[model samples]
Target: MTEQSEMYVLAIDQGTTSTRAVVVDHDGRIIATGQKEHEQIFPRSGWVEHDAKEIWKNTRTVVGKALVDAEINRHQLAAVGITNQRETAVVWDKSTGEPVYNAIVWQDTRTQKICDELAGEDGPDKYKDRAGLPLATYFAGPKVKWILDNVDGAREKAEAGELLMGTIDTWLLWNLTGGTDGGVHITDVTNASRTLLMNIDTLDWNEDIASDMGIPMSMLPEIRSSSEVYGKGRKRGLLIDTPIAGALGDQHAAMLGQACFEVGMGKNTYGTGNFLLVNTGDKPVHSDNGLLTTVAYKLGDAAPAYALEGSVAVTGSLVQWVRDNLGLITDAPQIEDLATQVDNSGGLFIVPAFSGLFAPHWRSDARGAMVGMTRFHNKSHIARAVLEATAFQSQEVVEAIEADAESVGVELTELKVDGGMVMNETLMQFQADILGVPVVRPEVIETTALGAAYAAGLAVGFWDGIEDIGRNWSEDKRWEPQMDEETRERYLRLWKKAVERTLDWMDDDVEELFR
Candidate 1:
């Protein structure tokens, strides 16, 4: 295919806070895009959910709008790729194609007690080592188990094989393929690795773990590679046969989008929270750093590529807190200018341990803490600190990544970054300064969608090799270290003390504190 006449690929990014659809030309230019925010359900304290139907509705609305905006026929689109929030569990009726329960979001802390109980009971750490994930509430297994135990009649139906269980990717794929008629329930390897269900090496549903959770394997979706033709989609008048060629968890897609093919390279996606992924090559680097070893991607069910992932429970949400809860700003993006107005945080550090510190710090009992707060610590300083906190937490993660990589003789010179937070130049610069390395921002910050699209495009003969992806990558800006050594040390010192104070405060249930 020539550069100009290359086929168009569409990617659906089903995120925690929103749903988006983008049309990318063969040249990697975003021809059209549409985004819609869905309602977040907080039925009980520490429990978070989403209406699966609402998610599908927004997906359809955005896809239609994006296709119209690009003035491209749906038939002309070569394929559709899906990149979604991982570990969010959904159970729906197999016959009616309707969700039986709301989607348990990744951010929900409802299954913490169950996770704690299960992690302590095992003789072997079989779940983590084999699945390439921890037995955390953030993963799907505990949440799936929780619903089966608590939700009325759920376990019975599951036993009788009346229910279908899937991560968001599988649920979305089923809907996109015209529901029950399609009879296509599947998940990509990347998303499957996030659930504490699939074996990392075997890349299939593990019987032992399912028996531990008392979940039936019959309810599970078929696991596939990140790229393949899964099924087709049908709407009112449009019977589109677009190949469902790719599906991946969001951060892994961003890794591919940034073209981080070689080992030791990393990408940080600044989503609602933060996710740092380091390509650990084909071998699963079982982390001693409290990081989750996960599938990077799979090439047509071949041996799966692996990565070490560090998840920060809060990053961008700190700013969202100020806007939605504190009413400091009308919008989150405005926090950048407000934060830059202040020279420093005035000795105040906001440790957003809101959802408990993730990655290396696995303490679920941690709570958000603000220290060294004099009366002079106003909104500007608070804004600066919050933004700085995001960088600091990410720095902690990078430290773990660096320390872990060193054991395997890998060195990180730069970090490839994408996601909504990269749009803030101030935060990007601060992240670079704190890490004391270059933070490279790509021209297409929408790397998540692009990653999915590229995978799909590659699967169907649109491209010849991964080198084509690397050649398409171009930097919009590269941020180098700017802060002095003394300032870095002082900031780090304060954050350490602040973190010391936050732990164990959550020893009790978070629902009580939330109330």
Candidate 2:
């Protein structure tokens, strides 16, 4: 048999916007890929939801499509891996395996009131130490608390151990492995960190934090390492006995995808949101700089490697807002062409803290705003400003990472780029120009899926080592800084001024809700 016929790895990437599957060969080349976008539910402002059934429907459809595209039997697959949007919460029945409600997505800010209340009454500082995360609406804990409190009989059922709570990964795993028919409910450490239920130290669901959040200890899923055979693959009519190995939050998986094994190596993924992660080796380096410490990834059952992460609630979504909301551009790709029309932003910067400013700032009252707009500014200038805003956000995150790393004596030199936004060469150059570092884009654009593939491949003996995976990776582009230091500094200063104006815009808007 040919190499293609011998072994293949299947990766399921459950992201913020879609569910996708990629079939990879032993050479690490993607032979089959299928993507399906699903609906986004908005019950109220800042609230987002996805039907768990819809997610599973998409997941099954893509896997079938990928298998067909590869023209291979399911038996050829040696193992399956999964990567997902972290912090998204879903609760389902243990016996019947059906969702109680729509999956509460990570971006949903409905729990903002709960977060505000926690942050005020001496709960923020206390939980931050225990969980290594702030009391934020962006995480899973508040969302879990929301469901337990607001939904009738939900809390009582959960406390009675009739329910199962999980992030997206666990939900997928449970369903894929024949839900309730010996189904497995397990989540990787990376996803667990975003839930605020897991103690970053012990890597287990903490009873103290669970008590504080008012979530029943019984509803939680078992936490597993990022890469290990957690269960079997049981896809209805087409069941494969491949080891269900590897799972992680999308961004953390991308860090491993970039082979950021050494300290100071980092990656910034630009998608619906932007996440910047810096590998800090074995030690879980606590952040004094308003950033979050999270599990990078785990190999087998060993302690999960750690990293510090900073999040921007909006990135490419801002461009989508202008196109989809303002009807400015025909498509998201038009943003690059439109932005290229302007030499500069004409003194405009957009702070898309649509939800809130995360990391380094941690200001929930900061709302989305466009600053320094003048009569000279048109859509082109606005487009340029939007792209530059993403870069400025990264600059802010890097500065925060620098400060935190300094407290622990680590210095970063470069960043690995991935996700949908990095496809624009113009944006990559502008990002490099602003940061004064060579921005490296890998030959593979879908590192999130690839990371999942690599993790699963490792477990099934299809791949040799992490070093082999790194060696197989190739670079497609390298962006170098071309801007003068003076110009860079001038833009940086103006960006800072713009950020200051955005900080407290929603203080009054959120007052009634927080009350």
Candidate 3:
């Protein structure tokens, strides 16, 4: 094998809004990076889509750009790792490699009626025990079912085994490895766990669920470990022959990247949404506290570790809505500057239930709202409230996690945070204050990509083991709670009040508008 120190891992992070590629050296430092944003297609109110072809194109573009930026070639990369938005379902023809329909984003709520029907028949928690998920539109199974039922000739093709279904990670992996030319169809346990079709205990597709949902079992991918050489890269624009080694859902990758290997260690990723996952060791702890039981990651043939996940539907995306829809700010980053101008939200609260609340309070009926706003409040206050919304949402999840952990006799001491929004010092500090725990930001904030890189590098013998990657983790900054108990209580109260106002928003009139 080549000296472990010399090889690089090309980690691809295909996200909701963008595609990014980064080259990481053995020491876990990002040598070079490239990123490109894609369009957010909203076919109608409460629906979202992404062109899989455009995503594939963006993947190639970013990979080429990263290689150029890093001054490296395909031969220099030891392996490729992929991390992507989980639960975004895509189905395509096996022969043509074209998606049957635009990829259904995880945030899309068009399947709510489908979910409601299923839950109504089987009860909302019917599959929760086996699948480790609730009957919600946030999962891949309903989305896949929606496409198969809605799209033209999809069911026939799927049942005939002429189609394939997978999450974004599986789609990218197939395209990266060989596309229509013998591309391997597979997904890691971490990604598979998000799909309601997978049995969390068996670590495979649940045949019963598949049958019940009317989904053809043949369309599913072979489940694989999070780290393994699935196949050799082929026909990729800039990468060829290199091993495609690792894959994870983005949030799971962040947990691995943060090196939260030990039980009770947790991390919060503030991406398009906010997700808090705590490593729950080998056994999946079924959450009675409105969290999801998920596979954190399964290394090569080892016992699949479990996690309790608190998924918030909207956080950073709220910032984008303020910028693009409301014109409150020109760019995402300016929210910080504008928000800092205010002492507080000026008694206003922004419950960005734009896609409804997720985690702890899975209120799909909720909608976006700016409550308690008066003439005295300005955009700066709204901006500050917007930023605070992320922190507040996270705090809700953390509270639930703490409750779940307490049941398991584990107490969380600190939170490890990563992702784009972690760069916002105000948000981080406020998050810390809200939880009353120190929020530690790793030196490598791009832990999602780094985690994928580590997985790929490990699989290809570029590193010794998990210990080697653990050494790469270093704390760059830490924020401790600053607000007094009274202030904290007041903020929580107002935030809860604002959240309550967003509920039951999809009334008959609103539903009629969408129709």
Q: Candidate 1 lDDT, tens digit per residue, 1-515?
A: 23437458899999999999999987777999989999989897667899999998999888988888988776678889999998899988888887878999998888887887777767225477788777677898888898889889999999999898999999989888878776588999999998898889888999888988989999889999998888877554232778888899999999889998888878999988899998888888887888888999986755677888889988887888899999999998999989999888888888888767788788777879988889888889999998999999999888888778765456879988999999999999999999999999999999999999988888886766688889989999999999998988888888888899999886555456665
TM-score of each: 0.96, 0.96, 0.98
Superposition TM-score, candidate 2 onto the true structure: 0.96
lDDT of 2: 0.86
lDDT ranking, high to low: 3, 1, 2
Listed per model in order, the count of residue pairs whose N, CA or C atoms clash below 3 Å is 0, 0, 0
Q: Taking the tens digit of each residue's C-alpha lDDT, what string does model 3 give over 1-515?
A: 65556669999999999999999998899999999999999989889999999999999999999999999888889999999999999999989999999999999988888888888767778899999999888999999999999998999999989999999999998988888899999999999999898889889889998887889999999999999999988864678899999999999999889998988888999999999999889988898899999999988877888999999989989999989998988999999999999888888888888777889988889998988978999889989999899999999998888777666556878889999999999999999898888999999999999989888888888888989989999999999899899989988988898888999888779989766
The local distance difference test score of model 3 is: 0.91
- Give stretches of model 2 more than 4 Å off: 1-5, 507-515
Provide the overall lDDT of each model, using Cα atoms, as 2-decimal numbers: 0.86, 0.86, 0.91
Worst-scoring 10-residue span by lDDT in model 1: 232-241
Model 2, residue 71: distance off in Å is 1.1
Q: Which pairs clash in the backbone of model 3?
A: none
lDDT of 1 at 36: 98
* Per-residue lDDT over 1-515 for candidate 2, one digit per residue giving the tens place of the 0 to 100 score: 53644879999999988899999877678889989999988877677899989999999899988999988766788889999998999998898888888899888777877877766768565687778898888899889889888888888889889999999999999988889888888888899999988888888888987887788877888888888888887756444676788788899888777888777778899999899998888878888888898889988855568889989888988988999889889899999999999898989889888887887787777878898978988999999998999999998898888888666566766678999999988889999999998899988878888889889888777787888888878889999899999999999999988888887666554656743
Clashing pairs in 1: none
